[model samples]
Target: MDSATRVQESRVFPHPINVVWNHVRPADFKFWTSAVKETQVEGGLPGEVGSQRKVTFKDGTVQRYQIVELSDLAYFITYEMIESNPPIKSSAALHTIKLRKITHDNSTLVEWESDYSSSGNETASVVEDSRLKKKEALQDLAKALGSK
Candidate 1:
C-alpha cells in the first residue's frame, strides 16, 4: 500500500467570490504567474471538465493536468497531473481548489489542496516546493486582481 502526501494552503483575496472564481480564474496562467511560461489546453474546451493542459514553467519543466471535476455553483475544481517531469516524474498527484465568498467584506477565501506521493528520493522536498509555488501564485493572482 502507498501513502499519499498532502499539502494544503488557504488565502483570502480582496475580491468578490464571482470575481475570483468566475471572472478571473486565470484563463491564461502565464498572465497570472511568472513561474508559468506557457499553458496550452490540448483536450476538450478550456475550463471544461476532461480538458487537459500542458504547462511549461519558467524553469523549463513541463507538466500536464486534466480537469477531473468542476462545479461552478460550488466554487470548486479537482484536477490530476497526468504527466510530469523530474522530481515528480514518477508520482501520483491530484489537486483540489475551493473558494468561498465573504459577504461582509466582499472577499474570496481560496483553499488549495494537493495530494501526491512521488517514488523519487525528493518526495518530501517536491511537495514543499509545490507549496512555495502555490503561495507565489496566490500572491500573483492577488496582484493581478488589483490587490496591493
Candidate 2:
C-alpha cells in the first residue's frame, strides 16, 4: 500500500463537553459502538496514554489497541491498533477523536477520524465497510447522548 487511507466523521451532541467526553471514553465504547461487543483494559490506567485494550466485536472479531495520545484540556484522544483480524488488517491503524464545545445551548461537536491501510487486497471494500461502520457508531453515540 502506498499510504493509509483516511476516513472522517463528525456529529453534534446536545450535551455539555464533559458529559459528552464521559460517554466517549474507551470504557463506554461498547455502549455506543455496536461493533464493540466488549472491551477490557489490557494495561495502565483507562484513559492514560500507553494504556492498551482488547476490543471484541459483535462479529467475534478482536482488535488490540494502545492509547497513543490523550489530552483532557483539549478534549482529544488517539489510539493505535497494534493487532487486528482479517478484512480490516492493519499494522498501523490510527483513530483520533476530538471534541469541540459549541457555545449554543452547551452542545458539543465531536469528530472521529481513522487512518489505516488494508492488509488484504480489498482496500476499497475495507475502506467503505469501515466508513459505514463508523457512521453507525456515530449515530449510536448521538442516540446514547440523547441527541436528535
Candidate 3:
C-alpha cells in the first residue's frame, strides 16, 4: 500500500475556544465552509461519533463522511470519508480538527489536517487540489469567526 498524501493547515482565531467550538459543529457546516453547497446528516446524530453526513459541493460532487472520533472536552474531532461521487480510490481518507486556547489572549488556535490517497495516476494533482481547497476553507472559517 502507498503512503497517503497529507495536508495540514492552522489558523489562530481571536475568539475564545468555546466560541470557536460552537462554530465548528457539523450542523454548521454549510455556514462557514466554502464550497459546501449542502450538507445533511444521513445517520446517527450530528456531532457524535458514528454520525454520518452527505455533503454536496457547489460543483455537484458528493461525499459521505462519518465522524470517527470526537471529544467535546478536548475540543477535537475526526471524520473519515465513506464514499465520494468521483470515487476516491484510496484505502482511507481522514480529516482531523483540533482547537487549543492561547492563554495569553484567550484566543484559540484551530488546526485542520487531512490524510488521503489517490487512485491510479491522480495522486499529485489530487494532493495539490486538496491542499488548495483546504486553504480556502480555512480562510472562510476565519472570516466567519470574525478573524482578520
Question: Candidate 1 has what TM-score?
Answer: 0.89
Residue 59's lDDT in candidate 1: 91
**Clash pairs of candidate 1?**
none
**How many pairs of residues in model 3 come into backbone collision?**
0
| Whole-model alpha-carbon lDDT for candidate 3 | 0.82
- Cα lDDT tens digits, model 3, 1-148, are 4666888889888999999888786643664456889888978988878999898988888999999998888998899989999876566789988999999999999898889876666667767777888778878888887777
lDDT over C-alpha atoms for residue 19 of model 2: 92
Best by lDDT: 3
Candidates ranked by TM-score: 3, 2, 1
Would you list the clashing residue pairs of candidate 3?
Answer: none
Candidate 3 off by > 4 Å: none
lDDT of 2 by residue, 1-148 (tens): 5557888889888889999888777543865566778889988888878999888888998888899998889998899888876435554678898999999788899898989865556667667877888789888888787776
Q: Looking at model 3, which ten-residue stretch has the lowest summed lDDT?
A: 25-34
lDDT of model 1, residue 132: 90
**Residue lDDT tens for model 1, 1-148:** 4457888888898888988886334344654476888889888887788998888888988888888888888898888889876446336889888899888999899888988866646667867887997888778878777786
Give model 3's TM-score versus the native structure.
0.90
